[model samples]
Target: MLHSLDADLAVIDPEYQLRRAARVDNELIYLTRTGGGGARFARRIRRAREEVRTVCGVCGRPGIPRTRSRTVLCDLHWHPLTAVEKAFALSADIPEAWFTDEAEIKNDAYVARSAADQRKESANHLSERDMADLLGVTVQRVHEMFEQELLAGANHDGRVVYPRWQVMEGGRLLPHLPVVLRAADGIEARTLQAIMENVDEDLEGATPAQWLAHGGCVEPVLQTLDQWWWI
Candidate 1:
């Protein structure tokens, strides 16, 4: 019966068998004997069906879905898998055990560290009202300073907080604050704070904030900030 079918197919198309057997020669031969191909063709069909059914959970586009446990991501999001994992970990409702890869574990660790740093920064910061009271001005004035870019404030859990290092006990902003803010515009708040708070060897291990408090020259700090800001 198989030979009769092959003879008829050959009459219709001389290269029919060759074309059918182009890649899956063994499967084609198996199909000729069993009237169907076996595991190889079965697997291929299953994969094809999955490709057709799957869609990206994020963007709703249809494609091959790569899974990380319960999370289904398409190729676009999968390429930056670590960043996706980090974002998930940072979410308030995420489970602690969702991380599956070593890279994800590392990202979770980094996120934890960042959260801790933010908490510390928040603890050391002053609210707008508190800053206004300290500076003997209205809260509206403090907001004006932020809007004018004379002082930098960071959003913490939806509230804007000003770092303590930017203000002195006498309610005066650091003289170099404007220069640093202008030079480091568009930089992350945490990064800008780190730059201002880091101890400089040139200043005998005094942080830029402390050096400025002691009336150190703003030129050196501005020069150093310009060098590091681009990097």
Candidate 2:
């Protein structure tokens, strides 16, 4: 019976074939035939259509195909700046044709979003007095720590503001705060803040601040910073 069905299917679809017959319990049985040639081609076309019709990665809405790789993105998330904008934003010379590469555009989008997130996080800053109170030390002691490079801060609107992540509850700094500060010495405060806030793949997706908070080793973190030329 299976042979009869297989012969009929082969005649109807020239690209289709069936094989692999076996005997089981003295009964003739056939192995499931794989989808080949025309059937497989049809399946691939269907899958490509599905991929093109999938939802956007950034938003839940249905996406329009945006790249040769068929990445789907909505209008809001599909915004790619021109080469001039990219060059200005990245402070580097970039060719207009560079944006034609989908990978480069995706990377630029990721970097832009990361920078925006870091900027938002950095807005939560602590003044010297606030830092001193949080650490249970005098304001002058906070200044001394900054001068000694034991802590880091940035000037905001004529007032110095420290990143709140540097200090923990119960008047203690992060366990590896000094080590990170020393390694990150001479790097700008904004860059250092971004490094601390960004998730490190080596640390299993934990931010530097979270890793140190949970008693992670500092050597690995320092090594990562060193590789980035931050040390």
Candidate 3:
């Protein structure tokens, strides 16, 4: 997605002032650059300025970063003296309260990483010309299909590409794709694609795509999405 990554999208985190707003990956990190200079502490806790990026502002780790402050963290230090993160935290001189037994951060990281992996798998996709030829439709009709949510297409760079799974044998559209597409309305393309590919208990252990591919009922999939993805 083309994000402005502006001040409006940032958050003033309690532990780390100025955080990059959660985007497609649902990951947040400190915004290191700032304009004003004041009391060291005031400058310390403000939300990240608009210059933040995907890498950690400190050690350049993923979401987690290494810094003198107890600001950025990874799952490793959820519990003090527990994992390598704890050791790193201790060395960084962060407060013990910064550590917790809750594994929420780890879980979120896993989820984001899994979604990213799914995106990579779907990256080798069909272009507009490919879709038009396969469906025996004009390229203009293909654009209409995307606008109507009749097809699943994600924006990579500045262009939109349709994932291969959206088409079945002989270039036919995947089963129930139109239904799922409508149900998934308003969600960004990459996330919608990930939800379709991710496994869910409500789908009887099948991913949405797989369940549909097997001729599963569209209602159950929609219901599952109500409680999960679509919600």
What lDDT would each prediction earn against the true structure?
Answer: 0.58, 0.61, 0.57
TM-score, prediction 3: 0.51
lDDT of 1 by residue, 12-131 (tens): 444332211111100111111122334543354344334334644444345442431223344543565366665765585644444346645554453454446446656778999999
Q: Which residue pairs overlap in candidate 2's backbone?
A: none
lDDT of 2 by residue, 3-118 (tens): 44455555545655332332211122222223343454334333433443565544435666565333456554567776566677456643444455675566557445545544
**Tens-digit per-residue lDDT, 1-231, candidate 3:** 114233332233223223122333322222222333234433433322212333432223444433322133344432225578677877898665445434445544644564564465445588898999999999999989998889988775567789777887798998888888888777666556656666766679887788888888889878755544121
> Which ranges of candidate 3 are over 4 A from the true structure?
1-54, 57-122, 229-231
Superposed model 2: Cα runs more than 4 Å off: 1-123, 229-231
Q: Number of the top candidate by lDDT?
A: 2
Q: Please give each candidate's TM-score.
A: 0.50, 0.47, 0.51
Question: lDDT score, residue 218, model 1?
Answer: 87
Better of 1 and 2 by lDDT: 2
For model 1, what is the error of residue 174's alpha carbon versus the real structure, in angstroms, after optimal superposition? 1.2
Global Cα lDDT for candidate 3: 0.57
- What ranges in model 1 sit over 4 Å off? 1-118, 229-231
Q: Whose TM-score is higher: candidate 2's or candidate 3's?
A: 3
